[model samples]
Target: MEIRAIDHIELFVEDAEEPAAHLRDGFGFALAGRGGAGTGLRGCESVLLRQGGITLLLTAATSADHRAAEYVRQHGDGVGVIGLLVDDAQAAFAEAVERGAVPVAPPETVGPDGARVVFASVEGFGDVEHRFVSRENRAGPFAPFIEETGCGRGGGGLLKTVDHFAICVPAGTLDATVHHYREVFGLSQTFEERIVVGGQAMDSKVVQSASERFTLTVIEPDTSRDPGQIDAFLAAHDGAGVQHVAFLTDDITTAVRTGGERGVRFLSTPESYYDMLTPRLGQVGVPVDELRELNILADRDHAGVMLQIFTESRHPRGTLFYELIDRRGARTFGSNNIQALYEAVARQQAARPAGLD
Candidate 1:
């Protein structure tokens, strides 16, 4: 199966307009489109914003009975859908369904421009859902209802398009979820590791297509080690779901520093983590002081080095966060940074009880 890069990330927000404004004003995205109707999507509204080929769909439920509302109620304002672009939508949907994927929406023709879109979802590593979207350009502003607008802002100040999403699942479900990606989506494991640092551990698997696109990193804590954020997310979210989204950047140091100055809080890595960076990633180009000051982390695999950092969860529900990644030639997730972030989040969670008024 040849899966392209991420098609789009759909989010269920408490107020679609608010987050949409934040993305537009804060991150510099253009409003790609908008949608809603008296049909099955009654009392609901959706806004699409785009920047660097990444579409952030923000949606909200206007009615109490709306599914969006129900999702927010269940998971808080978090990721509701992950759309993947495939060469063949029908074929992908059929393949997934044949392999036990639940059909959320059958292939249907929508829009006056005669575009055909087929979407179906399956249970992902957690409460997360995979939505496969197939499109053939037969559309009006991407969809029938969405009217295109000059919504994209921050054109010169944005990062590159979305690369892929890194999702955290329940502990012990790592292997099974990896199998789910392999069998259901015909994806193959690209990377695998059990990362341990600061006495924290997590098992992760990266799944991708033969084409090298459409990658997703599935992470689960190692129960044998100790309880951590993954366990807390599992308990709070009630199942598997997207944990954080990684935004790829050409220059990670600048990105992290800018994001930090702009009020984006990244999980801090222990100063000791840097003490061993020279030994672990001696060949990495960035300086250790730069990495420490920018709060970016560097790690290496046999292939090359990668830099990454996690943003603090901004959602009130403690779900859905962002990651800034600069993959210098490495195609793998920052395994070494996993435990750093896990411990960082654990400390934050621990202090929350005391910080709350």
Candidate 2:
């Protein structure tokens, strides 16, 4: 079984239209399609938005008995499905189930215009499900069953495909979670780090697909210690959930500027952090001043450099946020940038009270 890039992510929200609009207006995503009650979708409605190589399906369940409704009621608008692009959806599902992964759905076909798409799902951490999807109708942003609205793909913004996902699991489940990916998906642990900032501490393990097209960094807070952002996330989320989705951008500078102009607020780094960057990275891609101006973080490895910036929590519960990243040949997830992110989050935590501001 071979998993390619992230196929698409389905976010189950209380109301699909509102969140879908936020992404379209604020993040430059274009409405690709929609499906709802009248469209034979039963109790749920989904809004498909696409930009670059990223596609987001904002879904909301109308009935309380629906899985999406329960997910939203507990976690407050979070990722429910991570559609994994696979060579064979049926085979991937069988392999995953054989590896002890809980089966969510067996392979099924849904098509329009004589074009078929096969899909199956396996349970990921918490309520999140991994969908194995392959389509004979891969030309469009999505399958023909979604009822294309003709908004087309993306708003032609700098934001490209998804870079990685940051998943926050329960403290004691970190190792087990890492093992699940390895055992089921045949991914490997590329990097691991334990970081402490102020009273918060977390252990992170990065796992990725063979081609490095897919990456997931699982983080779990120190349960014995004081609650940090990760703790707040698990508590507020009511269980483990996706913390953030990092979207790739070809030009991060323009992306951040555009996001800000669209009224999207980003997390900031201290100016002092910039002064220390040069020594570690040793002549990075973006200049220090430019990085400082946008509060973007820059990090480098032996091969090349990367620039990244994160958005402030857009969800009411502070459980959902996004990161914009540009990789100019830097293979690893930014090690230095991760430390900087920890401190940045610490500062934000200090400024806000218990609940999301």
lDDT per residue for candidate 1 within 1-357, as digits (tens), equals: 457757778898889998788776646577787877733357788998887667788889888887678888888888888888776777787888898777776665555444655565665654556777667652224555566675542355447866667777777678888888889888988777777765567778888877665778888888887666777777667677888877778888877776666666777888988888898679588889898887678888777889888877766657678887787888777766666776787666666654331
Model 1 weakest lDDT span, ten residues long: 137-146
Best by lDDT: 2
What CA RMSD would you report for each candidate?
Answer: 2.9, 2.0
Candidate 1 yields a Cα-based lDDT of 0.74
Give one clash count per candidate, in the order shown. Answer: 15, 0
Model 1 clash tally? 15
**What lDDT does the true structure give each of the candidates?**
0.74, 0.85
Mind sharing the TM-score for model 1?
0.88
Q: Which residue segments of model 2 deviate by more than 4 Å?
A: 151-155, 350-357
